[model samples]
Structures are given as C-alpha cells and as structure tokens.
Target: MSYMKEFTKGLVKENPTLVSLLGMCPTLAITITVQNALGMGAAATFVLLCSNIAISLLKKIIPSQVRLPAYIVIIAGFVTFVGMILQAFLPDIYDALGIYLPLITVNCIILGRAEMFASKNGVGASALDGLGMGLGFTLAMLAVSSVREIIGNGSWFGIKLAPDFIQPMTIFIMPAGGFFVLGCVIALVNRISDRNAPVRTGCAACPNKDGCAGCGTDSDVKEAK
Candidate 1:
C-alpha cells in the first residue's frame, strides 16, 4: 500500500478505538475531561511511535518463540521513558492519568500492530502505521471526552458553557455515562460511514488464523467444526 494509505487508514477506516475497539480501558477512564484525553493520547502516541520503530528494527533478530516477550520489553521501556517525562514536565497530567500511563505497555493497539504489521513491514511503513493509529486513537479519545465534558460538566476543557438555567447531567461524567457515550459515538461513526459489521466465518476466514489455536491444530479445527 502507499504511505498515505497506511497513514490515513487508521483515522477512520481502521480506527483503533472506534472501529477495531482497541484501548477502550484508557479511552473510557481518562475521557472525563479534554485535558486528560489529550494527555493520555499524546503519551500513548509517543510510546506507539517509538515502540513500532524499535520493534521493526529488531524483528529480524528476535526469535519467533520469544517475539511476544521481547516486544513487551521494548514497549515497556518506551512506556517508562514516557512516564518519567510526564512526571517531570507535566505532573498534573501524569497524576491524572495515574496507572493508565504505565498500562500503555499492554495496550492492544501497540501489540497488535507490532505482531500484525510492524514486525512484517519496513521501518518507514511501520512508523507511519504507528503514527496513523496513534492519531486515530487520540482523535477518538477527544471525541468521547468532548461529549462527556460538555454534557456532564457543562464545560469544554473546563470552561463552563451551559446557561444558568441549564443543569449538566452528572451521569455523563460517570462510568455508566462512558459506556453510553462510547456506544453512541460508535453508532454515529457507523452511520456516517455506512459501514457494515464484519462477517465472521470461523477460523479459516479470520485474519489471525495463522496464530489462532483452532486453525493451528487439526484436532482443534475438527472439534470446532
């Protein structure tokens, strides 16, 4: 694919958070405010970009048996580096993000791209993929947070917007509100894009078929059938 395609696909076509449903943990948790969403998005994008490049460079040397563990180590190192930078320079955001900052090491978007794309592609392509996916993830967070903050707190980025007669619904900032907003956003995106849900035809048709246990083992496949 062209470089532009690789970079643009994640924006909407294969968005990590909205379309693929990756990284929902931090998405739902930190999206109560726009500042928190931006902070988390920036941190995650940094880690994803660095880790994708590093993994692509090391793919040849890292054995298949240990690739997963090695990828985790590389991802964790970048996550740690990001954490220190955040703590020193952006302490408020660092504290606001809390454990979710460090949890980026295990984020499915990073690892999935490493396993499915970065390890198989050249460094330039991997970097673009990482950047695209990261930006997509960030945009998704911003969308969710914007709705939550505006409706829940009657503000945008902490600035009050509601009139004196209007009351902000406290529920929009709550956990239940996160789910509701996420579902609504996903529905809206689907409607706007007019995309149909993917059809699942079992192991043989799965993208991860090569690594899937059922597809990897004849006995398992027979049993599943």
Candidate 2:
C-alpha cells in the first residue's frame, strides 16, 4: 500500500475507537470533558507514535516468543515518560486523567497496531500508521467528549453554551451517558460510511490471520481431509 493509504486508513476506514472498537476504557472514562479528551489523546498519540517506531525497528531483533512482553515494556516506558511530562507541566490534566493515563500502556489500540502493523512494516510506514491511528483515536475522543460535555454539562471545554432557560442533562456525563453517546456515534459513523454490522467469516478479515492457528481455515480443513 502507498504511504498515504497507510496514514489515511485509520482516520475512518479502520478507526481504532469507532470502527475497530479498540481502547474503549479510556475513551469512555476520560471523555466527560473536552480538555480531558485532548490531554488523553495527546498523551496516547505520543506513546503510540514512539512505540510503533521503536517496535518496528526492533521487530527483527526481538524474538517472536517474547515479542509481546517486549512490546509492553516499550509501551510502558513511553507511557511513563508521558506521565512524568504531564505531571510536571500539566498537573491538572494529569490528575484529571488519574489511573487512565498510565493505563495507556495496555491500550489495545497501541498493542494491536504494534503486533499487526508495526512489527510487520518498515519504520516509515509504521510511523505513519501510528500517527494516523493516533489521530483517529483523538478525533473519536473529541467527538464523543464534545457531545457529552455540551449536552451533559451545557458546556464545551468548560465554556457554558446553553441558554439560561436550558437545563443540562446530567446523564450525558455519567457512565451510562458515555455508553449511550459512544453507541450513537458508532452507529452514525456506520451509517455515514454505508457499513453494516460486521460478519464473521473465519480469519480472513483478521490482520493476524496469516500466523494465527487458533482457528482452522478452509484450506487447512481441505488439507486435513
């Protein structure tokens, strides 16, 4: 695939949060406010970019048996770096994010890309994939947060937007609200993209299909027969 395709696919075609449904924990938790969303997005993006490049470069050197552990260690290092930077310069956001910030180390989006794309692609392509996925994740957070904050708190990024007569719907900022908004957004995205519910057809659609052995393919069944 072209470099452009690598960078652009994550924006919508394969959005980690919206389309693929990765990283729901942080997405739902930190999206109560736009500032939290921005901070989390930026921190996650930085970690994703750095880890993807590092993983891609070291993929050949790292043993396959231990590659998952190695990827976690690398991702954790960057997550730690991000935590320190946030604590030092943006203490408010750091505190607001709480444990969710550090939990980026285990974010499925980062690890999934590391395994599925970074470990198999060149550094340049991996970097672009990371960036695109990061942006996609960020944009998804922003979208969810904007709706929640606006409707829930009658504010956008802490600025009040609703008229005096309007009452903010507190539920939109609650855990239940987060799920509702996320489901609505995902549905909207699918509608806009003309996509139906995904169908399971063995491993053909999986990125790791080539190496995964948990499921047998038609060819494998034929061969066995």
Candidate 3:
C-alpha cells in the first residue's frame, strides 16, 4: 500500500481508541476533563511517534525473539522523556497525570502500533501511522471528556454553560463517568460510521458477544445481534 493509505488507516480505519478500542485505561482515567484528556493524548502521541520511528529504523537489526521487549524499552524511554518534559515545562499537567503517565508505558496503542505496523512498515509509514493513531486517540478522549465536562460540570474549559439551577450530573466528573462516556462515545461513533457504509458486527475470536474486545475480526464473524 502507498504511504498515505498506510497512514490514513490509523486515523479512522484503525483508530486506536475509536475503532480498535485499545488503551482504554488511560482513555478512561484521564478524560475527566478536557485538559487532562488533551495532556494524556499529547503525551501518548509523542511516545507513539518516537517509538514507531525507532522501531521502524531498528526493525531489521533487532532479533524477532526480543522485538517485543525492545519495543517496550523504546516506548518506556519515550514515556519517561515525556514525563520529565511535562514535569519541568507543564508542572500542572505532570502532577495531574501522576501515575497514569507511567501507565503510558503499557498502553496497548503504543505496543500494538510498534508490533503491527512499525516492525513491518517503512519509517515514514510508521511515523504517519503513529501520528494518525495518536491524533485519533486524542480526538476520542477529547470528545468524551468535553461532553462529560460540559454536562457533568456545566463548563467547558472553566466556562459555565448552564447558568442557574444547572445542577450537574456530578457523576460525569468522576471515574465512573469516564467509562460511561467512553462507551457511549464509542457506540455513537460506531453508529455514525456504520450508517452510510455496510457494516459487520461480532467478534469471531471472542467467546462472548461480538465487539466485546478491540479486535476487528467481527467483519466475518456470525452474530445474533
């Protein structure tokens, strides 16, 4: 495939959070507010871009047996770098991100891109994929967090939307709200994306209901729903 096609796949086709549904932990954990969501997204993007580039550049030199570990180290190094940068430059974000920043090391989005795309693709293509996926993830997180914050807190970036008697949901500003918003956004996006296009549902590899996991094997899977 052309480089553009390779890159675009990560944006909408294989969007890390929206389509693939990977990296739910950070997505749900940091999306309580728009700022937190944006911070986590940017940090993940930086890590994803750097790791994909490094993995693509050294894919051939690294033995297949140790590729996974090598990728983890590369990803972890970038995450740590972002952590320090945030701490020094954006102390507020750094403090808010907290332990979640370290969690970026294990974010499936980074590892999945490195193993599935970066390892076999060219550096340019890998970089593009990383950027696309990073941006997509960021968009998803922003979408969910924005809705939550607007309704749950009656504010967007600290500006109140509902004036008087606007008692916020309150829950939308908490951890549980994150999951609720995430699931709702995913479902909403899926519906919109599938409306005009022929869509398939169900997870072929899963033992439970279809679309339970992030895998896209649902295309050929048979389902009752």
| Pairs that clash in candidate 3 | 203-210
TM-score of each: 0.90, 0.91, 0.85
Q: Which pairs, if any, clash in model 2?
A: none
Worst 10 residues of 2 by lDDT: 202-211
Please tell me which model should have the higher TM-score, number 2 or number 3.
2
- lDDT per residue for candidate 2 within 86-111, as digits (tens), equals 89998998999999998999999999
Residue 99 accuracy (lDDT) in model 1? 94
Q: Which stretches of model 1 miss by more than 4 angstroms?
A: 198-225
**How many Å off is the CA of 152 in candidate 3?**
0.9
Model 3, poorest ten-residue lDDT window?
Answer: 204-213
Provide the lDDT at 55 for model 3.
97
Ranking of models by TM-score: 2, 1, 3
Model 1: number of clashes?
Answer: 0
User: For model 1, how big is the CA root-mean-square deviation?
Assistant: 2.8
- In the range 142-216, model 3's lDDT, one tens digit per residue, is 999899999888888767788878789999988888888888987887787673333544343222322234443
